[model samples]
Target chain A: MNRFGFFILFIIIIFSSKKLYSKNIKVCSTCEFKSLEMAIESSCNYDSIIVEKGIYKEFNIIISKPLTIFGKGTPTIDGNYRGEIFEITSENVTIEGFNIINVGESFKNDNAAIRIKNSKNVTIKNNFFENIFFGIYLEKSSFCKIYNNSVTGKATEELYSGNGIHLWHCKNILIENNIIKNVRDGIYLEFSNQCNVINNISQNNLRYGLHFMFSNDDTYRKNNFQNNGSGVAVMFSRNIEMLDNVFQENWGSASYGLLIKEINDSKITNNVFLKNTLGVNMEGSNRISFKGNDFIKNGWAIRVRGASYSNSIVKNNFINNTFDISYNGNINKNLLHKNYWSKYNGYDINKDGIGDLPHRPVSLFSYVVNKSPGAILLIRSLFALILDFSERAYPIFTPTYLIDNEPSINKSE
Target chain B: MIKILSYCFYDITRGYWISIYLSFYLFLGFGLLFLNNDISSAIITLMNIVIYLVPFISLIFGLTYYYSSREFTELLLVQPLKRKTIVLGQFLGVSICLSLSLVFGLSIPFFLVGAYNIENIFDLFVLIVLGCFLTFIFTSISYIISIMNDNKIRGLGYSILIWLFLSVIYDGFLMSFLIYFEQYPLEKISLAFVLLNPIDLARTLMILNLDISALLGYTGALYKIYFGTFNGIIVSSIILFIWLLAPVILMLRIFKKKDF
Candidate 1:
């Protein structure tokens, strides 16, 4: 009976102590924990800080513990253009259902709405960021998930604006379903590896919708990039898979749907490039595979510039672009096969879907325009057409081996 | 002038040649629509044929009609009509007949294809207007050529050469100029050269109206800034009008002092 009494006391003491720690700390204007900073300071590890629906006019709120910063009904954290709002310096942090706004703009430093530094397994979900210089910056972080967040900036110039989601030395990050716009580069990934950027709409930015530098083994699929200064630019990257993205209406003299420089062994498949000034401007890229893409109404589709070698361009639909392919050099080390060109007027006498004769994607007019851009004024002129026809009869100025061997008669759906 | 214009108009309208021209356009329009099936793309294809073929046909047809009607012209000269009225009337009559044929022929197929609801209706209207301008300009030039040289074969050769120069050879020289002086800034000079050639001017006008001007890159952007606005369009239209007026006035002046 004495032993049973001792056991009952032990169970009661354990339950009371467990409830004393790891409890919900509610913060509001009327609550005992009035401010978010006080609540975060007083709360122990593994505690949940519930912020109610009110505008918390505060900045520089640093969370250095493993805490769940939960919002009751999307509480507003107004930085008032002061500084960074929430800096997560701890691991296993999950901050959701918050409206973070008015992040301070700085030229020397990137002041983000939420800056995560040296963190692991941080999940930033369902947050709305506005008027921010930088949004959701991850520095030297890994295993972060930024999902369903809309990061918008009111930036007018490149020098003052920062990226919507900036990842530096990040790994295994998942960025999905985010609507990012009006920043310098919508999603700037530098030295970030094994990142999956999917289902994001990045449009109308001051610069490229997405920019990658020195990143490898990254995959960005099903993203919509439109009407920016340019579309996505991947430079000095390798093993990148850009699949099922829609790039549209990115038109300017120097704009491109996808610009790759010094990139090697990338696979770009099933993407739609529509109405861009130059779709796929490749320079010094090697062993890249372009398959099942639709190039529609672009200025110059796939301008293979200096030293782009061993590229297999196959199964893509070239529909009514001003120039199907523009090559700078005379050497042709790339392979183009089984592509449907709308300007192909050859016959299929063998009852097969492929044409009997090859389709030359590059014309002498494009070659001339490449040599002298002023010659583009004579496009669609009678002289240019006759020149293109005669050059086809004898391959003189254009790249001779840049021909689609099995040109498809019908467009692939 | 109105009586002379009416007589010339009715006479050309009754000719089998006008009907053949109308039927040829009808066949081309229908065949292009049937092949493309997309109204917007059909308009693009029509643009290619119309830019070159329209001027070619207008030039040759005006020369042939004038050469064949020399006796009729002499007969009209013996009447109480003035040379200015006769020259202007014949020019208006031939241009109007060819313009009507082009408009009606292309419009039927487009309307039947339900292109009235397409947003490219404005482009089609621009096309018809440009076609009329080409006809008027080429016909007046042909009239001036016929009046200058009394020999029919010489007149034919000169008119053909003029068409060839404006449509093809002028661009050849411009291209050579562009290639030879590629290091120089050729924007202003190319725009000036395009303004000089009526065929290239019409092509630039129509291409700028379409969204494909983005493909033209820097020169296209410069052209868009100069010719894609309301003021620029007005200036281009005025330029095309001057091209028409200069030849017509010259033809009238040459006929006024002719030794025939």
Candidate 2:
């Protein structure tokens, strides 16, 4: 017998021994193992428990073993206003196809429908969570997958509401295809690193749809955030890639489509911000690149407050925003390059789709309103128009260096 | 009064001036709509032009029409009509023709472009209605200026100055005042100043219907309190109506006691 032939037979024998050792356990009211807790306790490692179709009124179903729990007909686990339904502490546990409800309301401890603590390689998929304090709480966990779940919380007050999916000090989590509403924040990450959040719908949340604080290297793409208090807030974060998200209709004095505060080394590309009070309220954010985004019909698109430095705003379409680029001070440290402004009426005589003259985005009326907010009442007045025209002909009050160098004459890219 | 109003209406409509004015607005409306390619944005451009052009054209046309028809006005004054009837009837005749021409002209493009299905129809309605108010307000103001001054050049110059002040100079003064006294809480005071000018009031009314109202409320809670309610709209429109009435009543009184 050659060495390669023996190696293949040895691999087949090891796989056949694992299949021969692991067994399936049945869980139902009429079955031998009536309760899920008893079934989980009696099952051995690497065993699969198939739960039948019945209402199991249980709470604190702790999983400290490596077992895969699947529901045959999606059985209901009614917590009945009790504490945490599934507390996963061990690694390599999978929980799928169950309806969890009525997690006890504890504002201090945050009772979640499914709470995974200090566990790795946990997979939770295709679950329905209703009337819970927190939907999925991932703490100090790594390589966790939360997929295809729906979380609806009956939260009204900001203080009483918990987030739909809260991650604290976690790493390398994937949260995709989740629908969350009526929570404080749809998805919140605090100190969590390298998480990928994609294809989520978070709308009508009481606070921000997705909030990241001190979470680095997070990529969120193709998420729809609408009608929340604000769409997304990334504060004190770095190396974040936000791509192809749609933020719309978050309208208030304090609300913005995306609030980037104290963030650095991030890329925001190809997102559409529509009808927000202020789209991209940027403050103290440095070296961030904003490219190929659309700002449509917002009150203020990219209002740069103090200390936002070296940010290159390139190739974005600014269509019908009341003020395209509102800067508080006169020091222009950012680059405005090759953007399309609908208000740019400069001649494109060179016929390269770029205007012949540079376009000055901020008007004197916007500056006056910034100086004295009462002057906003004079918007669109003929006197304001005259002031803008004269300031254009004779530079004053507006930043002279803030010009779109290659302003597109038409709406292209 | 009705007979004199009808006679003046037929007399104005018989001239090519009314057709030319109507066609100018039609061409402007269609051009703006074509240029913007979006009905909502087209309404914004039309608002800017209407606020400036409606008053300027009304002031110029009102003064010129009044000056050119002085002999006809004297001929009607010697008839059995009361002075109140002659004055208000001729004023109503000019106001109605201008208002109808503006409203009808701007609306044709909207209907043709199917803007009536979108939500911008209400904004269009406000724009044209404010343009009408501007026509009435400025025509009455021009009548006051024409009646006060016997010299044609002085009246013409005075009308231009008033338009300049109301449309341009008044906002400049208000801006400088706000910037100068920016320390004080001037939301209410500045709102009161906006109410004083009919042109600014008309502009404010149009702005309230657009998304820019959210920006107006972004200053402070005081701006939101003042400019965020239906009562704010009602109050502004009432102030605009008062601007129309006050000058009109004064013009009637001055023309009644004039030595002509």
Candidate 3:
């Protein structure tokens, strides 16, 4: 009976210590605070500083205190063309609903709308940024949540340009639901790890809509990348999960909906690629699963170049392309499986989604293009049509294994 | 007046300072080559001499040819020589000197490159000749401008406008036409337009040399049919000659009647 009583007391002590781990306080203008930092510095612990709706022409507000800074009704934080606004070095700080504008542009120093440097457990949400170079720059920071922010820039020349949300050397960051446009890149992730980017609309950027290099174990979902110079370039990274994203209308001689170069072990699933010059241009990418995505009405649906191996295109839709798939080399290592193709003339008798006959995606015209670019002019010609039909009938020049045995008939329906 | 025009020709042709312009051309060509990552060495060398140097030298010589003629016109009008003979002499003198300098600038490097049995050597020569021809066309254009407009800025503006038309805006306009009539047989349309612009002719020639000329769609086909085969080269040369000679003849006719 005495031992049982001791166990109950131990449980009670553990619960009480967990309760004592945090404290919440509110700071208003009437509550002995003119400036944000003054209120923050004087606050006791874990304060929620409710800033009033006024233009705070503040430069470099360093939040050392653990606080949640919520601005009421889109309070403007003007940097006054001086420097960075909030230089955060504290943990568990949440700054939300503030309109940050006119961040100072410099070539020497990396200035931002909100500079999160070496901070952990940070949440930056529902904020609007204008004329910002690097909006919500996370440098050597970890476990941060940056969501629901609109970041924009009007940079004409490429020299004095930066990303909207720049993540550098950080880990376990969640960036979601942001509308970023007219910057160099909407979200530029470099040397980062274990990040989540979801539901972001990134458009009309100079370089890439979403660009990441050497960043691994990241998942980006439900993001719309449209009308960018180069849609989205994922380079030199591995183990990425990109799901339900729309990459569209990135048209140029070298532009693509998504350019996955030198990447490995990535999964691109349930995404929509439309009207790009080349949709999903894969170069030096290996062990990537491209499944359940829709490649609709692109110039070329898929382009594989140079030694890309062990990649799978499964359960995707390839609809109405000039060429469905273009491969430079005959050494086939990529697999196409169970994809719905509009041009698939196969019978599906078993009442299943999979077709009975194999769909040959790589055409002889595509092979001719690989050798001679001028052959594309013969595309609409009757002679070229006969040549393509003859090649398709024999199946000699194209790669033998590039066939989807199980092709779905009615995808859009 | 004829003697003075001959001196102007000699001043332009014998000048050692013209090498500065050649160096600038080489530098610009080299810069363009370096910027393009996948451009082959053969193509780079071809473009360096053909596109960059030939056009620039031709333009410089042609402009100098026209400017010298304009300067000579002031003296020629006050002299005892007939207006037609003075104009004819000045034109002959300028054309001879300008053509010589252009050929010299182009052929020296080309002969060295072609000695190695390079495949594009013949096309390079053709492009250079075309460049000289383009200069002749522009020179004739400038003569008309110099007669009609007295302001140097106006003349310069007209030259720049013409340059923009040939180089950049012409392509944009062609693209719009192609896009609008996409359902039609674009090959014939492009062929018609190719006759109108010498730059387009040069561009077609260059693109045909590239393996990816097929990527240019219907316009590429027009080029292929007209410039792709062995017989096509002869046809292109003839077309270029027509373009070059037609403009010069028109300018001379206009200059003959106009009160300067």
Candidate 4:
């Protein structure tokens, strides 16, 4: 043996003694392996199973160890057109570029296209889920990044359906850049904390585009919720920031662009509300800062009721709403400052951008809805004419404190 | 008749009729109840029932009327009865069937939930009936649409389009106007808009019943002074009647002009 052969022997020995080893396994739908579940079950550590591009009918593939499953060009793992396809129970798992579909609907079971239960640091990306019940559900999971995935479901009713991306009891999750449509909820967070949802488009969901319930310390930015039935609702949550999101085309008598209930210490800024029945319906919400929002072409810009205290509505553009602001209670603890009122006829003095006089937004018609239920028809009559003028003159029927003191002369971004 | 009855029965009894609405209404009722514990669940439940029942009954009945007019037209037209009788019969049949279903689905569950007193439930029952009447009003219009168009898809599409326009777009336009005229007195404008859309009137009725009208604010105050009493219910009924009557009469007039 020469010096060169001895050197090659030494290198091979060192490489073989490494901590981890990987193997690539190719599985096709036509293969005798029969299912993706079989292929996954048979795989081991440091294994990369590349699934072929076909609809492989399988269900409930549980991965209990570290693995990397890569699908080549959107290989679909359908639940035989029936149930949950993948349930991950391990840490350090990656499921990339797969189409998971037809998750089962059952009251007895919680089915998902990909359910990550009790897992951490799991990365699921670039997957497509079509007509699934629960797409990418994470229950009791933490520190997961679900990125660049699209989940679509046709949920007619709320009973037999689930959300596009549901995170329950999850924390420190980053769900970014996903497009979801026609599900019960596009993105749902329940009892979830510290999640970041960025740059997602959720449209036409049956119930809500994005629903957060008891989910605290979350920030959702640059998401578009359009034409959903009830729009987006953030309820029973606190310490949240919803920035630069567009909530539009959610129009129904009971619907609103954003419904905030029982929320405190949150910031809703730079949001666009268009063509919604109610732009923002705040109930029992306190200390919320709504700034620099654009309320365009909505029925009611802000409908405040019950314990909605100390909310600051500042630098918002109230453009083209039937009612700029409606306040039911006598107590107007909320503050409206420097908002651009399209209806404001007051002149700007001192070369400042603020209006010379405060804009009193509460209309007498809202007062009629409170005092008498039958006077809505007289809306067209001259009687409504005199009453509104009298109220505006006296400023008595409407809440005295519900005044936008520093209304902006021009709209702000 | 039996075939139609069977189809309607199957649609209703198979749990398909109210599932969509039930899910939403129940969720809304429970959610609101839990969120605002001070506000009675009865209020939420009543509002949910009214909101869900009115539109759903209208849509389903409208579609069913359209379907029957399209599907069994040959027999319907060739019958010995006048076109008015045939149209009215079909309209009433659908209305009755759907009203029955709404009553069964909502009233029984409402009683079970123990949300309201007998008087309020009775009042709700009357409101649901009125809602059914509103559904038939639209159904008759859909029937006219069916008669005018040879294509079922076009007819259905037109109905849905009109529904969307009235339900979504109209309110948006009104809101836009309100925002533009924010400095002006908008109480009268909102009331006028509500009168134009019977759904708005229906919603007002339900909300006032639940005492949630305060949520609408100063605009709501304008309405409350004018239309926020028991007399408002009477006005809503009148408006709903006009909404039902006008389209149906127009449909009847147009039906005579239609080739079918």
On DockQ, the candidate that comes out on top is 1
Tens-place lDDT digits, model 2, residues A100-186? 888999877899998999989999999889998999999999999999999999889899989999999999999999999989999
* Model 2 CA deviation exceeding 4 Å by range: A1-19, A27-35, A53-57, A73-75, A80-83, A330-333, A340-342, A345-356, A404-413, B32-37, B230-234
lDDT score of residue A53 within candidate 3: 82
Q: After superposition, how far is residue A79 of candidate 3 from its true place, in Å?
A: 1.2
For residues B24-135, write the lDDT of model 1, one tens digit per residue.
8899888988887567667777888888888888888888878888888899999998888887888888899999999998898888866455468899999889989999
Task: Give the per-residue lDDT of model 4 (tens digit) for B1-260.
Answer: 54454554454445554455445445654555445433333554454456434554565455655565464655767766566655555555665665565556555545555546665665566566656665666667666666677677887788787666665566556644664666676677667787887666666665554433434444466566666567876776788888888877877777666666
Query: What value does the TM-score of chain B take for model 1?
Result: 0.96
Measured by lDDT, the strongest candidate is 1
Clash-forming residue pairs, model 3: A373-B214, A374-B213, A374-B214
Instruction: Give the Å shift of residue B118 in candidate 4.
Output: 46
Which stretches of candidate 4 lie above 4 Å from their native place? A1-20, A29-34, A370-386, B1-260
lDDT of 3 by residue, A1-413 (tens): 69999999999998787557644444455555767767777765575678888877888889886788899888888898688899888898899999999898877877888989898999999999998877889999999999899999886666788889999999999999999999988899999999999999999998899998999999999999998877889999999999999999887556789999999999998999987878988899899998888998677899998879889988888887668998877545678877888887778788876788888988877776655553454333333455578877788978787777777777732
Evaluating just chain A, the predictions reach TM-scores of: 0.94, 0.94, 0.88, 0.92
Q: Which residue ranges in model 1 land beyond 4 Å of their true spot?
A: A1-21, A330-332, A349-354, A408-413, B19-40, B103-121, B229-238
lDDT of 4 at A256: 78
Backbone steric clashes in candidate 1, count: 0
Docking class of 2: medium
Clash totals for all models, in order? 0, 0, 3, 47
Task: Summarize candidate 2's per-residue lDDT along B75-185 as a digit string, tens digits.
Answer: 988888789988899899998999989988999877886745546888988898889999999999989998888799999999999999988999889989999999998
Candidate 1's chain A scores what TM-score?
A: 0.94
lDDT agreement of model 4 with the native: 0.75
Local distance difference test, each candidate: 0.90, 0.89, 0.75, 0.75
